[model samples]
Target chain A: MSEQQTVGFTVNGERHTVSVPTRELLVHTLRERLHLTGTHIGCDSSHCGACTVDLNGRSVKSCTVLTVQAQNAEVLTVEGLAGPDGLHPLQEGFREEHGLQCGFCTPGMLVRAYRFLQENPDPDEDQIRTGMAGNLCRCTGYQNIVKAIRYAAEKQTAGSV
Target chain B: MIPPSFAYRAPASLKEALALIDESGDDAKFLAGGHSLLPMMKFRVSEPAVLIDLGGVPELQGIREAGDRIHIGPMSTENEIIGSALLQQKCPLLPEVARWIADPQVRNRGTIGGDVAHGDPANDHPAVMLALEADFVLRSSQGERVVPANEFYFGTYFTAMEANEVLAEIRVPVLGPGTGYAYKKLKRKTGDFAIAAACVLLTLDRGICKRIAITLTNVGPTPLRASAAEQALTGKAIDDAAVENAAQLAMQICDPAEDLRGDKEYKTHMAGEMVRRAIRQALERAKEAK
Candidate 1:
């Protein structure tokens, strides 16, 4: 059993309220407390970006951030990326471009890429490599991951999904 | 895994935080973004009795331009430095180095002050700070004092910061016109720590070197200044041959010990390569001057 402290933050455009310990990681709060298990935890060491999320419009390793550090911050998890119609452009681009293999790292990759595109919407393959280098995929050797980002860039540019 | 149980305090002000740290004494640890401290805690390496969270201390965050110097708060995140137009335009070398720091997530939380405060030779920013001739503002209940980067780091993970002191800000003087800068690294993977890294900042007068600074990272017990290399190209036109020779001088400064990432001789050799590359990059940047 863990003692709880009052915590509040915006999760995916909705105000989600939860209580966690001062030591509770944002990753654990999302997975256990709020039940947003879609953001997988491959390595809690922040080496693997599998638990990446958007905090206050920036991509962060949730495993490294305590939920208390997230109080009053706007957060966007992988589960919120999809639209009412279906998958977001990045999701479609990943599906059409084959960005994953084992799929464990996809959610984190998508979230990281989602923020990357907003920052550098028209980055080339090389820039994509450098920008997305933080997110690791043990299954695929990054060739297809670069392709997915490129597809998203093109889709976002043309304004046609 | 959860971090070991510890009391926590999020002081709305730096004063309160420092007081808490002072009140708690040796058992307390300052938690910034937790990019460094948290990982160590998870691994059970350091289980401090209490965490004085610096997240609420607004005084410790942000990058500001002041009096020919860039005053970066100790809690200024790597992501903030990379995204700051002021730092980029004034000193492109910083964001250039910041980009290669870690992956994006760590950058978002891993802070410059934390990096400097940790004083790890493996940490890239301290070496760059040495080349930049940066000064650190340390605060405790007593008062504030500035420590030059060269004197701040005493050894591996050892700095001059006192137990009660908090790193408040970093002061960086702007490189005068005709100045050029570069940072180069060789990591097995893009996100991995550098086997060896080099930061070079210099000024040229009509193709003749006027000033120079060189620092190497992850090559010794402390991030080191390449004094021999700096001395080599003082009056000469810093060309490929000059860079090659200075890189050799940088190799002479490395005292790498064997570890998981690389062997001693290999790290020594790579230090030369990084210096060579960094010199070339700085040269490319130098061309932009009038």
Candidate 2:
């Protein structure tokens, strides 16, 4: 009963159309079919947020979303973080603040921070912790990660002004 | 961890979705947000042959005020619920409770309807729904039916919703003046299910308790309404003794299944503790309510 459907979506401003089985997860489609392996799958259950991605302007765990359900949707991944100018502020903050140790949860962290900033540009330390609660990191104890988000928030605010 | 092979259909409208489910037979499952069902599918706990995606149904979205009540589309995500100004002002309890659910990514995709329909005691919404005394609108090919949240849940993963029915809307009465509510959840960590959570909707007339509804989450086969606890404080000027008595009454009804969270004794005690804390908070808010 595996039904294949042609799903068309825009990823990081690039249009992609692929035929995928209905049961294929969005994270799998992005990693395998599109070869954008930036999205990592930590816990196959929806608990871990390593598969976080932006779908239609909202941060969603791609592991739980079926690829076929994302037809005509706009998706943003960790690979789409940097622009032509340089690394995105979040990426820069991660580098500057030493946000990652193992680097396994960085992609998801960056993407989730990207959307979290969009939702709350001037979030406090508590807000950052709560907003980014979906994602888990076995390393760094989340101290650097929170600092990185603060760094990005300040940088973006300063740049905007 | 991949879900078994299943044909998927995304219907553009509610009518089309109902018709597709009818045609697909009983082996078909309605997919909403995919947070609850997909995880089960990954574990092979549920293996439906067909998945009817309801994401495209326009009627199953949005939150609006209708007369004295609020009509929330079943498809509205937890984030959407948290962001709704209408709900924030009219029914603050919902948005407050929604915040305590999973986390940002999970909240973005998890729908209130899905949480209620799943009928999982651990799900935060069912307890809140019972506390607020919400109503659910179930739509099927036959017609539409309205069921109150108190009567909707049967047991773990068992709901009053028929196989062919779709949760169309959730209706909750707007909280009036002097009504204070709180949903206190005790979980191990972020995105974790509650050890024992409590939802309290309290109304006070002057210094005396006018009305109150106390409900516990993840403490039983279904979300348990602490009716005895509520009755204990109904007309009293809630003091330490009343709160303690109410909490004990709430604990008496708990039958939590032991797992990683805690053993039966700890869970049941936590249920009472949560009720105690929630009631005290609700009492303070009720005094501040205007």
Per prediction, the TM-score for chain B is 0.97, 0.99
Worst 10 residues of 1 chain B by lDDT: B281-290
Question: What is the model-wide C-alpha lDDT for candidate 1?
Answer: 0.88
What are the per-model DockQ values?
Answer: 0.62, 0.88
Clashes of each: 0, 0
List, residue by residue over B67-159, the lDDT tens digit for candidate 1.
Answer: 899999888888888889998888778888888888877888888888888977898899998998899999998899999998998988789
* Range of the 10 consecutive residues with the lowest summed lDDT in candidate 2 chain A: A43-52
Pairs in clash, predicted candidate 1? none
lDDT of 1 by residue, A41-120 (tens): 88778888999999999999899888888889999999999999888989998898888988999999999999999989
Model 1 segments more than 4 A misplaced:
A1-3, A158-161, B239-241, B287-290
Docking class of 2: high
* Per-prediction TM-score to the true structure, in the order listed: 0.94, 0.98
Which regions of candidate 2 are displaced past 4 Å? none
Error of 2 at B181 (Å): 0.7
